[model samples]
Target: MTRDDPRHDVAAVVAALVAEASDGQITAAGALAEPDSLALLGLTSLGQVRLIQAVERRFGIAVEPDDDLVALDTVESLARYLRERGVA
Candidate 1:
């Protein structure tokens, strides 16, 4: 992961968000790496809101209420979405 790679940065950010949301219970060791790991994050509705807010603050991106939240269902997808949105 380099400063020149937005996807890597996005992945790092997503990992951080997942870590924060999980209170470090989840790590970047494939805990949230795959779509199947989404449930392991144990995000509630409020946790989701907090994660969104953290992402917006950390990456300077706005996540509208109508945005397809499913894109964040997995770490890779969230990283891709952030990269597409220029969040790197």
Candidate 2:
């Protein structure tokens, strides 16, 4: 996929948020490119908060506090969310 790919942007955002949450332990784009779990990437509950906020801001959508975060726990899942939620 190109750099502008939705998944790529999702991965980039996920990587940045996870890295910030995990204290710089997992910022590699290559790793995030195929990452299967945000938990594995060190996304804590607090990180998920930042991620949600960032997603809302970057995607220009309102992610409810009661939304299913698990659906956003992976880059692919989030990409699907963007597609299905009519945000992409």
Candidate 3:
């Protein structure tokens, strides 16, 4: 597989994961536009679980239960966090 800068590409992964988890209820633009408002993105309780799993799998990093959910609210923010962890 080809690789790119995680800083630039992480948003795509996050967007895809959110779309998959949300079942198309949210779009990448909408999610990126409002990176801090997850509720507005239609992320339900079940969707949250799916998103977390997707993140873990994509980044190969396990998210601890103590991790703040609020921090993963946006594609950009999530990408930044993952990139910081050397996921790129």
Candidate 4:
């Protein structure tokens, strides 16, 4: 799939994770303001694992340990991350 493919709904993925982790305090758009570090989101080890699983299932792709998602910090970052990983 191309970069603009509908299947690569990075905003939705980020929103889902933010909602799941923060109980709705952050949103897809709001996630853009998060620090450029994955740790700022309080994504614990378990949370990261869950997020990775969700992303994999949603995108129908396998996420390697060194995948771009590990460096993702913002919604845009996540979108580009998936794109770079050839998810769509």
Candidate 5:
């Protein structure tokens, strides 16, 4: 992760948003890169919605209700997703 890498910044923001949405249940130091991190972070239905909303607002992107959330399963993937959407 470097300042020159958009993914680095995107990943950090995503992690921060997830942490906030989880009420600290999910943290940057809690191995947010694992594929199962999303499964564990979103312990509740409301949590999932909140996480999506937070990220959407921050990046001005929308995660349609029909979108496959697996793309956001990990920080890296979410960062890539954001980059693909022209976030950087």
Candidate 6:
């Protein structure tokens, strides 16, 4: 889909994943500080795998197991990453 497509709002997906990772206790402000202040929310390596799986399932997209999703550290980054991979 095109970048401007409403379906390409990767931030929403990422936010959902972050909320899931945090067990729904993380608010928008909290998730934004993930990997730093929100490190206690279980955003670990295993959590990353779970997030990827969730993203794939939610979006009906197949992401390579080794795909570089680590760079998706922020909502904006995740959106750009999805766009670059043609998933958004």
* Candidate 4 C-alpha lDDT tens digits along 14-49: 657655655554554566566575457565666667
Write out the backbone clash pairs for model 3.
none
TM-score of 2: 0.65
lDDT ranking from best candidate downward: 3, 5, 1, 2, 6, 4
lDDT (Cα, tens digit) per residue for candidate 2, span 1-88: 7876765565556556556655666564633665577777566777777777777777788876686766766766776676667764
lDDT of 1 at 18: 75
| Candidate 6, 50-88: lDDT as tens digits | 666777787677777587755546655665677776764
Clashes of 3: 0
Q: What lDDT does the true structure give each of the candidates?
A: 0.72, 0.65, 0.77, 0.62, 0.74, 0.63
User: Where is model 4 poorest over a 10-residue stretch in terms of lDDT?
Assistant: 21-30
Worst 10 residues of 3 by lDDT: 1-10
Off by over 4 Å in 1: 1-8
lDDT of 6: 0.63
The TM-score obtained by model 5 is: 0.76
List model 1 lDDT by residue over 1-88, tens digit each: 6777754566776877877876776676554455664665666666667777888898888988798877767777777778889865
TM-score for each predicted model, relative to the true structure: 0.76, 0.65, 0.81, 0.62, 0.76, 0.62
Query: Which pairs of residues collide in candidate 4?
Result: 1-88
Off by over 4 Å in 5: 1-8
Better of 1 and 6 by TM-score: 1
lDDT of 2: 0.65
Quote the lDDT for 23 in model 1.
70
Candidate 3 regions with alpha-carbon error over 4 angstroms: 1-8
- What tens-digit string does per-residue lDDT give for candidate 3 at 33-86? 774766677888888899999889878898787866566777777777787778
Q: Residue pairs in steric clash, candidate 6?
A: none
RMSD of each: 2.9, 3.7, 2.6, 4.1, 3.1, 4.1
